[model samples]
Target: MIAVSLLEEYGGIIKNYKSGDFIFEEGNRPLHYYQIISGEVKMNNYNDEGKEFIQGIFYKNQCFGEPPLFIDQMYPANAVAVIDSEIIIITKDKFLDLLKNNSEISLKIIKNLSQRLYYKSVMAAEISSQDPEHRVLRLIDYSIEQLNFKKEEAGFLINFTRQQIGDLTGLRVETVIRAIKSLEKKGDLKIINRKVYR
Candidate 1:
C-alpha cells in the first residue's frame, strides 16, 4: 500500500465525504486516484427498475476506481461513501507517475487487481448457475477470503447488511433473507444478537 505521507508528498489531497456522498459517478471520465484513509466505500449501479447492484466494497487503506485511471475509460459504476469517510485524492497523471517510478508498488497494484478479477469471475459463475443459498454462501465466502475477515470465537462475522448481501449476490432481499435462514438451519451461519456470523 502507498503511504499517506508519500501520497501527500506527491500532490495528493485528503478530503472527507459524508455518508451516501458520491465520490464519482458512472460514465464520468476518470481523473483522480482515490484511496480510503478511513471508513467504507461501495461501487454500485442501479438498474432500470432502480434496483441496486453493488460492484464492490472497500474499507480503510484500500484503493478504489483504479482501472479507469489506468485505462482512461469512463467509470463503469458509481463510487459512494458507505460511511463518513476520508480519502486521499491524487490527479491521475501524478498517480501514474508515482506508479511508474515505483516498481514494487506497481507490482503490488497488479496483484491487487488480479485478485479483484478473480473475485469477479467466481461471482459471475455463482450468479449464473447457483441457487440463491449457494450464491449467498459463495459471496460470503468470497468476502471472508478477500476482505481479510477474521474468525471470531463464534465464527467469522459478516460485516455486510442483508440488503448489501442481496445487492452483491444478485438476489432480492427477501431471497437473501430466506437463504440466510436456511443456511443458519443447516449450521452454516449464525444469527448472534441479530448480527450474522459464519
Candidate 2:
C-alpha cells in the first residue's frame, strides 16, 4: 500500500478508528483502500442465519479494500477495528492514477501482490490439513514475519482471546481450549494468565 501511495498525486487522510468501529459495512460502495497504520482490523461476514465469521484479521501496515475498488463495487465484507487503530484511506481514483503514472510503484505493488497471493494459497492449503493449534501457530508466524527480531516485545505483540483465535482458525471455543492444551503439553507453548502462549 505504501509502495502504491508513492505515486499518488493526492495524499490520503489518517483516520482514528476506535476498537469495535466499522470502517465500512457489507455491500457499501468502495471509495478507498485502507492501510492500517496501527492496531488490528478484522474483515468479517455474516450468514442469513445471523452467525458471524471472520474472513481475516489485519495488523499494522496491512492493506484492505483494494480489489473491490477497481471494480467500482460495494465491499463484500465489513471492515472493523478489533483494536484502536490509525489508518490511511486512499481514494481509488488517486491510487490507480498513481500506479499508472509511476512505473516503480506499479512494479512494487505487483511484487507485493504476488507475495500475498502465495501466502493466501498456502493458507488455504494448510487450513484444511492442519489442526487449530498448528493453524494458530501459522497465523503468529505470518503476523510476525519480517520482524526486526532485535526489537522488544518480539514475541506475540497482539494478545487475542481464545474466541478471537477461534474466529480466525474456524475452531469453537472449547476446541480452541483443547488445542492450546495440546500445545502446552508438548512444551511448544504456554498460555499463562490468559495473555498468550508462544
Whole-model Cα lDDT of every candidate shown, in order: 0.94, 0.73
Cα error, candidate 1, residue 54 (Å): 0.6
Tell me model 2's lDDT, rounded to 2 decimals.
0.73
Q: Can you write out model 2's per-residue Cα lDDT over 1-198, one digit (the tens) per residue? A: 474245233678789999999999998999886888788888888878876777777777778766677778889899999889998887888888877877786786677667666766777776789878888777656645632122235345535677876776667889878887887789766666665646
Q: Lowest-scoring 10 consecutive residues by lDDT in candidate 2?
A: 146-155
State the lDDT at 18 in candidate 2: 97
Candidate 2 clash pair list: none
lDDT of 1 by residue, 52-135 (tens): 999999998999999988788999999999999999999999998999898998998999999999999999999999999999
Among these predicted structures, which one has the highest TM-score?
1
Off by over 4 Å in 1: none
